[model samples]
Each structure stands twice: as structure tokens, then as C-alpha cells.
Target: MTLTEKTAYLKGLMEGLNTDDKVIAAIADILSDMAAEIAEIKDDVDELSEVVDVIDEDLGEVEKDIYEIDDDDDHCCCCDDDDDEDYDDYDDDEDEYEEIFDDEDLYEVTCPTCGDTICLNAAMIEDGSINCPNCNELLEFDLDDIEDEDESESEE
Candidate 1:
């Protein structure tokens, strides 16, 4: 039986006892009040559960829209490689990007503090120094030595 029904039955039993004990009557009244409060709390919880389910469904739809999720597709949007044509297009774009940077000399420098390799260009090297992005340590380049070597090489 439901808690409310059980409490009501107990209350009816207590009333039928016709007891002179004030304590028994008071306990019965407390039990009845507790049952009512519990029923109200259960109803609130049920309503909240329904609201949460609706929100969850809404969130799932939003995620599908944002991520371009397809019901039949198993792969994630970013990592999907099912289309060979699209993959070839991506490769062409990458090759174009490489061609753009081919004329410019790229230098790789390893940070002494963090051991992270950083790629730089001639202009950045001419600036003499840059902070290591990983550790924020000041790294100075000896441009004079590099210039002297280049000059010597040209002379040779």
C-alpha cells in the first residue's frame, strides 16, 4: 500500500482505539503530517524528472545539429573520412599551402627550457630573440654570428 494509504489506515485505527493517551494521538498526527509532506516531495521529484528528460532530449537534438551528426554515420564530424573526393580536395589544399611557404626559409629551434621545437622564419630570426612559447623563457639568438657566417659563405 502507498505510504499515504498506510498512514491513513493507521490514523483510523488509532481513532477507533478510543485511547485516552495524548501521546498516541500526537504521534498519529505527526505520522499523518509526515506522509503528506512525503507525498508532496514525491510529486515535485516526478515533475523535476520529467523536466530533466525533456531537457536531455533537447540537448541531444542541439548536439546533433551543431555537430552535423547523422543517424546512420558512425564517424565523428571532424574525423569522418568516408568521401575519397573530399579527402583528395583536402590534400590539394594542403599542397597549395605548402607551395605558398616553399619560398620562405623555415627554421626549427628547440627551446632549452622546455625542449619544445618552435618553427620560425627569417624575419623572426632577425628579431634576435623570442620567448619560448611553452615555458615563456627568454631565448636569444646570436644574429651577428649567423650574419658573419653568411657573409663568409658568400665570400667563399
Candidate 2:
């Protein structure tokens, strides 16, 4: 039986005993008080359990809202697997740029911090540096390094 039913049974048994001993009556009174306290504690625990269930349901709704927000976003990397398609578009743009400008006359440098590919002329690589558009980090290219490599290759 449930704890409440068991406590009720004990109370009934104590009442039926009709004991004359004062000690027995005092003990019965203490038992009654303990049973009542236990019932109150049970009620409190039930209320707390209901509150926990409601909080858990609210958390689930928040998770659904977060998912919906992600679903509505088209360019979010976490929401879709079309990152390769984005890269393909970048490649197409690069091809079109190459058709308009001679690739040999341009130097391509990728920003180390932001991975932004920047096209620079040979003169710019020698004396100029660019700040990355995406991350605003300074990017410097050393054209002397290329000249050094070429000289070493010619000596060999």
C-alpha cells in the first residue's frame, strides 16, 4: 500500500487499541504528528515534481524556437550543408576576374587570420600591404623572398 494508506492504517490501529497507559497515548500522539509531517512533505515533493516537469517542457520549446531560427537563415553554416556550393560560387567569380585581368600580372595572397584571398599587383607586393576586409588584420607580402628563391635556383 501507499505510505499514506499505511499511515492511516496505523492511526486506526492505535485508536482501536483503547490503551489506558499514558505512555502509549503520548507515543500515539507523537506518531500522529510524524504522519502528518510526512504527508505535508509528500505534497511539497509532488508540487516540486510538477514544477520540474513544466520547466523541462519550457526548455523543449526554447530548443524548437532556436531550431526554427536556424531554419529561417539561408547563409548560416550550421543550418545547411551547402558550404561547397558557396565555395563554387567563389571559384566562378575568380575565373571571371582572371578573364578580365591577366593572372600573371596579379599576386594572390590569403590573409592568415581570416582566409580572405586578396589579389595584388607585383608592385603592391613589393612595397604595399593590405588590411583584410573580413577581419581587418594587416597582411604584408615580401616580394624579396621570391627574388631570393629565383636567384638561388639560377645559381644551382
Candidate 3:
């Protein structure tokens, strides 16, 4: 069942109790748990909506013709590309960028520190380091940072 429906069901259960105060408090506690699950589901949906999939190969069709904010970058998943190309993979002379990484979504990130633009799928950023071709500057977080972030999030 959908998270919203489940939350509503829990709310109804909490509302229907004509029993002792203890039972009512127990139902309230369960409702809180259900509400937290619903919030997580909402977050999952919001994150998934940011995913840019050009083709649903399983469905044999492309529903949303994915386009980029600029012509110079396409969020391609392949990370084995030459490190020295300096955005030959892009369309034209483009300078600015930001990380559009979703966990399963492809992201095209430009390194402000080294002036190197990178096309990272979920896999490359999973490690989180795209070294610059010229100065070899390590731009953005490495895998360690990613793990740290996960740990902090779990603690929350």
C-alpha cells in the first residue's frame, strides 16, 4: 500500500480508540512510527523524481526527452573517459557547474578548484573523486567523505 494510505489508516486507528488512556497512548506511539515511515517515503519519491533517465529500455520507449541546462555537459554514466580531455565531451565553451548527483541518478559536475568539468554517473561519484588533468587537483569529496556523510545521516 502507498505510504499516504498507510499513514491515514494509522491515523484512523488512533482516532477510533474508545479504550483506556494507556491503549490510546500506545496507538499514538504507533501512529508516530507510521508518520515517520511516511516521511521517509516522501523523501524517497522526491529524490527519485530528480533522476534523469532518457530511455526506459524495459518499456522500450523514452517518455521524458532529457535535456541539460547547457549544451556543454551531458550526465553520461561512463567514467573510463580520458582524464585530459577537459570537457571535449561537452558541446562548447562552458565554464560553470554544480553537482547534480542523486544516488542512482547521473550527475555532471564541474570542479571549481581545478577548472575541470567531469561527467559522473552514480558509480564515479560513489567514490567521489575526479582528479584534474592539468594540475591533478583532487576536486570534490572522495569516497571517505561519502561514507562519513552516510554515518552522520544514520546518526540523525
Candidate 4:
């Protein structure tokens, strides 16, 4: 049974006893007061629960607006485009990127001080040395030694 109903039942039982004891009368009054307070608290809790549900719905709408969430599909607004022409344009951009960078030779160099790897082209290496981007330490390259090693390897 509900707390209020249980309290009411107790009050009825106390009244039926017809006791002359002051303690029993006081206890019954206390139970009645407790029942009233519990009812008010239950009402307040229900109202707050409804307010929370409304706030949750509002927050959902705000999130949809901020993130461009579509209800129709799982994809974001940008990826929802059905046009093949837009996809073709993206492919053209990728081809242009490949054409520009495919011909150049890229070398990976590791910094001794910071242990960070950096990519460099031939023109950058021709400068003989570059400051390590991570540690600002001067890193020198001896192209003459590398050429001699290459020559020896060819002779072998």
C-alpha cells in the first residue's frame, strides 16, 4: 500500500482502539501530519519530473540544430548530399593533389635530440642542415659521405 494509505489505516486503527493514553493520541496526530507532508512531497516530485522531461526534449532539439543532425539518416548534413556531381568534383581535387606531390621525392629524417621524425624534400636537404622543428637543434647532413657510400655500393 502507499505510504499515505498505510498512515490512514494506522490512524483508523488508533481511533478504533478508543484509548485514553495521551502517547497514543500524540502518535496518531504525528502519523496524520506525516501523511500530509508525504502527499505534498509526492506532488512536488511528480511536477519536477514533468519539468525534467520537457527540458530533455528541448535539449534534444537544440542538439539537432547545433550538430545538423538529420532524422532521416545516420549521416551528417554534409554527407547526405545525393548529387553525383559533387562527388565527382571531390575526385578531381584528389587527382590534382596527387599530380602536384607524386613527382617529388620525400625523405624521412629522425631528430636525434627529440626523436621526432620529419619529412624533407631534396631541395631542403641541399641546404646541408636544418633546425629540428621539435627541439630547435641544428641537424647537419653530409651529402658527400652519402655520395661516396652510393659509389662504393655501385662498385660492389
Each model's lDDT comes to 0.88, 0.77, 0.63, 0.87
Model 2 ranges off by over 4 Å = 1-17, 67-80, 83-156
Ordered from best to worst TM-score, the candidate numbers read 1, 4, 2, 3
Model 4, span 70-135: residue lDDT tens: 787765457737745658889999998777568899899999999999988787898999999999
Residue pairs in steric clash, candidate 4?
none
lDDT per residue (tens digit) for residues 1-156 in model 3: 765666667667656865557776676677768778878988898777655342245233333335223345464647554644765746333322333343446666777776666676766666657676657878666577777999999999
Write one digit per residue (lDDT tens) for candidate 2, span 1-156. 765576667767867988667786676677767877888999999999999999999998899788654555566567557656747888889988777576558767888998889877766666757788789998876668788999999999
Q: Write out the backbone clash pairs for model 2.
A: none
Give per-residue CA lDDT, model 1, range 14-123, as digits (tens).
88988888998898889889999999999999999999999999999999899888787666566546655667888899998787567899999999888999998887
Error of 1 at 67 (Å): 1.8
lDDT of 3 at 62: 32
Could you estimate the TM-score for every candidate?
A: 0.52, 0.39, 0.24, 0.44
Q: State which candidate has the highest lDDT.
A: 1
lDDT of 2: 0.77
- Provide the clashing-pair count of each candidate structure: 0, 0, 1, 0
